[model samples]
Target chain A: MSPSIMTKGAIDCDIHPSVPNIEALLPYFNDHWRDTISQRGVHDLQTIAYPKNAPLTARPDWRPKLGMPAADANTISTQALDTFQTSIAICNCLYGVQLLMSEDLAAAFASAVNDWMIAELLNKDPRLRASIVIPTQNSEMAVAEIERVASDPRFVSILMLVMDEKPLGRRSYWPIYAAAQRHNMPICVHAGSAYKHPVTSVGWPSYYAEDYASQAPAFHNMVSSFICEGVFSEYPDLKVVLAESGFSWLPAHLWRLTKFWRGLRAEIPWVDRTPTEIARDHIRLTLQPVDAPPTSEQLERLMDHMGSDEMIIFSTDYPHWQFDGVDVIPDGISKELATKIMVENPKNTYPRLQ
Target chain B: MNIQLMDRVATDQKIKLAIADCDIHPAPKSVPVEIYPYLSKRWQDYMETYGIIYRQGFPTGPAFPKGQPNAARRDAYPPGGGKPGSDLDFMRSQHLDANNVQLGILNPLSCGQGVQNQDFSAVYCNAVNHWQIAEWTSKESRLKASLMVPYEDPSASVKEIDLWGGDSNFAQILLLSRTAEPLGQRKYWPIFEAACRANLPVAVHAFGYGGAPVTGGGWPSFYIEEMVGHAENTQSLLTSMVFEGVFERFPTLKLILVEAGFAWLPALSWRLDKLWNRMRAEIPHVTRPPSELIRQHVWLTTQPMEEPEPREHLLDTIEWIGWEKLLFATDYPHWDFDEPSRALPIRVGKEQKEAFFLKNALELYNLN
Candidate 1:
């Protein structure tokens, strides 16, 4: 009955495999990319997207003396997998590949990141899975990248930034979704952005805290765009995993969204079912950084509002200081709900995992 | 016949709380031109020649598409053909009188608070305040108006507050949640200081014509996105105000966050307190716990009331946000307006119902 009782063999739906530097990716890259990196002097194009030194980016204990925090497979395994007894951990590398301006360079880096992820992390651990990072700036190139990685069973999903060049629901992005649906790859919309626009609608925020808090609204917008633009209806089989996007806000958002959609349904007649039904069917949110109240009872109340336990998939958000040391699953979660979040929910969401 | 008689008896037996609707949005009868009378001839010519300029490049309208025309309920439009909230008689019959509302606070969102031209914004805001007094409050004794001010220009805003703050007809200083800068920034402290001096609680309604997107990121793709987007902006503003020591500077200034439902309050407050505990060194000016400041200075209106699954969760959240801080709101004429008769949960005790529906707002605005 205790909240801390670990749900053994749980699946960690989100774990970041830090790309140490551009130089670290040299081996996976072709000779042209290697020479281009050297010629251009592309020294760590890593952005403040996940600021390297941010306390939230990496726990103090997880930090390595040198290089990036989760640079080594051994470190991630010890800190994330072994510690949580994770049966599977989906590696989502949030490097600045999407931030690159040039399509060619962005495409090249995306491939190299995936290749490096497989070699450095997935190959080392059989239980590890990954989301294929795609060049969102170029839809065709993004599809090409998805096609290239489709055969790899370890690559369970296609990773994307929430704030891209355009809303993900726009037709321009359909090819990527089409490729994902064809490959049974769920589109994983991660918390960080491509910085295509100001983090807030008003303009850039003055503080990192503002930027951090902005992620929820970004996710909400993306979800709205997806539902309104008929993305879920168009690609019926397509699933979305909102990674590092907290779960507590979902119930309220869905409630408000459904309320508006009732009066506004005529605007988008293509959306046949209710907004909540569409979201409940297609969307899955990761559970780390739960963003719930301090106590277990409060968390239970939030979960009750969410309506169903199936929407939350377990995630440590490894190397990120979301939860304290062994409190991977925050308080207020019952053992039954924890089991669903950690095991059953992830399996139901990721078709490839099954 | 027996069932009908029983139903009528049950309805008659139900208790009705003295309702103080905190967020009643009264639209202009026609257009922004309604305020032209209160402006100077030169300014009137300026308004006629050039329209209000917002900061963003998007077209002048709501960001997302609405389900109804002007996003108002179909039943709310007047029979004579005007905007939903524009017709005062219709509003009273449909909302105030029908609901037995004791006091209705008018928050006119169309006053153009986020105009880039400071002087024009001030003039427009002043006109809107006068219009509210003339068009709504004076006509209906149960109604009260919020003093409108161009928040970007602190001196002008203060001046406007001083001009209208003493009026018993106006209960609070009206501000849009989405301003050019976070409301807590020192640039805005002057208005807060003026409000404190006038003993007027600053009321921030969700959404504004601020050229900024409602979210921290840019404009949302859909209206649905924009619809749920207010909470994020509200959260940032709340954090900015608390962390920047606005409360410490003006201890008497109270804030009422309207239309941005209360469910997020407990979580946001907890998060702010958590971050403040660890990062207190960064903002040493914030003397007390962030949660403590929130409890002391902030009040939230209930509209778009959160329908958590079990429904009991909402009651628990209200407990987290003290019952005394909740003000009942209907967001009248809009499609999602809550009927006061059925807005609160049925199980609520009469005392709690009275506190939420009337007492809290009365205390905040010094109605008693």
Candidate 2:
């Protein structure tokens, strides 16, 4: 295998710190929630969003003989931080917090998850940062959770699922964006769903592969909603990161959007700038699951089409095996582009890192 | 946007590219009464009383509100203010003759393929097929028609193919990407079988009023969502066709995906090949990698052409998808039509321009 591309000060933007089970979260949870969980027999609320045993979920070499993959900070540090020589890594916990029905319980669990990260991961690793998971079931509770976590500098952004109960750009979710913008936190829209709606507009997909591939369209819809609903215009300072969502589709989407927007501009006059300009200013995507052609030339061509180098940030997508070891950066990019994706772009995107 | 149009018009006046427009919708001048002669008396009465009972619960019109009347360009409407694509003289003056189109392939999407009543759908498809040749293709020698089939009933679909499959005017068989099931399933095999037997390529377009949402998840909220949803639906169809061994079973079948963007093709092919490599045991019938089958059998129409940023990325995508596989389509009279002159990136070489604009489609349809 090739040596790790991680230079000394590389920023690993996406590293999952797995919550092994609900019981591990009980200590951080309040007594009422603890009782509620016990009463409901909520043993292991581990989400099927990323199947625990799926090969893609954990690389063969990274899999632990004793416990779940990346279950603790030590596993993460060894497999991600040390291996990649990461100076700073962001922990994005993708649990079933959004899947919970009760708004109160969901909020409490989200808060508990964030607290557990601080104690078990963030505080232990000073180089680590975390995204605040919010209960999207209720926007008010979500904003409250954001407010609760805003004071902590360790929390860098708010993590969200791509396919939520409603389009994230709806005014109902504006309060969360408002709070994130107020605190200068970027929103990371991860490639997963709350399962409140079918992943596609038609209905449920039959296979895991279909479900996985469908995330691209979900991202496409989310981006459209955000742009058309004037989310970026409303919260101009906010930067939205599309985590684990592939980047290949962006250029075409932007092109089509710009074309349609020109014809449909009279209806949505609020969108004063071109769709491409708006998206370039606001949207950023990770590079680990860089869904480009498997050629260096093609990759370079894609970057050229992206119009700016600043839109992509370096990520390992650690423990979620998107690429082979040390090939975390896809082929086709030059050393200069690689450095931009690894260090310069992430630093530019996340003001907190500065 | 206005400036872009003005610039395009100026460029269009100068550039006289003889192109084969692959996708042109020919709507009835009024309600589809022209097809009544082709339909049985019972079906004609059924149409009069109940109208078309589409599988979808939503209204028969497009899911999203159109930006233009009938979702057509304002200039495309006839002098009498009837639906665009209704008046051939107007279409000739406005689009066909104006653009110097060598041949235009008609894809009639308004036909009742999504109707709940199977017999009505079959009759409607048959009527439209005959109507296309009678009203459009025969009237204009430069125009060619696609043979419509009642895809839900494969036997009826076969019957329709048998009727017009040998006709010179009918160039290919038309199927929608969104059908009762993925087009690759065993149930839809007969349609493919008939098409292959008739030596006709299957042209699968994006829109279908199938009860199911365009995407597998459910109905999308916005017009843009529904519009962009075409890519996902086409992806699912391609996956189903490839994984289900449809390509292997009917190696002679040729597929033309219209109104779907081709930029996603390279990534999709890579992802599928990767997955197929790992999950080969699940589908033993697929003899070759999915990409090989796609390159061999599939052709994508360029209507909503992928405009990659740096612009050259469009060239890269075309290179990956293979220049030979792209068929230039205008999606005429629609709001999102691509003018032939400005459709492709300026960076495309003369040979590639020739292939994309005219030659590739000519060879595919055997127009030569």
Best by DockQ: 1
Q: Give lDDT tens digits, candidate 2, residues B68-141.
A: 76878878889986788888889999988889999899998768686789999998888888788788988899
lDDT of each: 0.82, 0.82
Model 1 DockQ vs. reference: 0.43
**What fraction of the reference structure's interface contacts does model 2 contain?**
0.22
Instruction: List, residue by residue over A14-57, the lDDT tens digit for candidate 1.
Output: 99988877778899888998998899888786777667777777
Q: Which candidate is the best by TM-score?
A: 1
Q: Hey, what RMSD does candidate 1 come out at?
A: 3.4
Model 2 misplaced regions, further than 4 Å: A1-5, A101-105, B1-15, B55-60, B153-159, B180-187, B212-221, B277-287, B308-310, B345-348
For every candidate, the chain B TM-score is: 0.94, 0.95
| Worst lDDT 10-window in candidate 1 chain B | B1-10
User: What is the C-alpha local distance difference test score of candidate 2?
Assistant: 0.82
Q: Count backbone overlaps in model 2.
A: 11
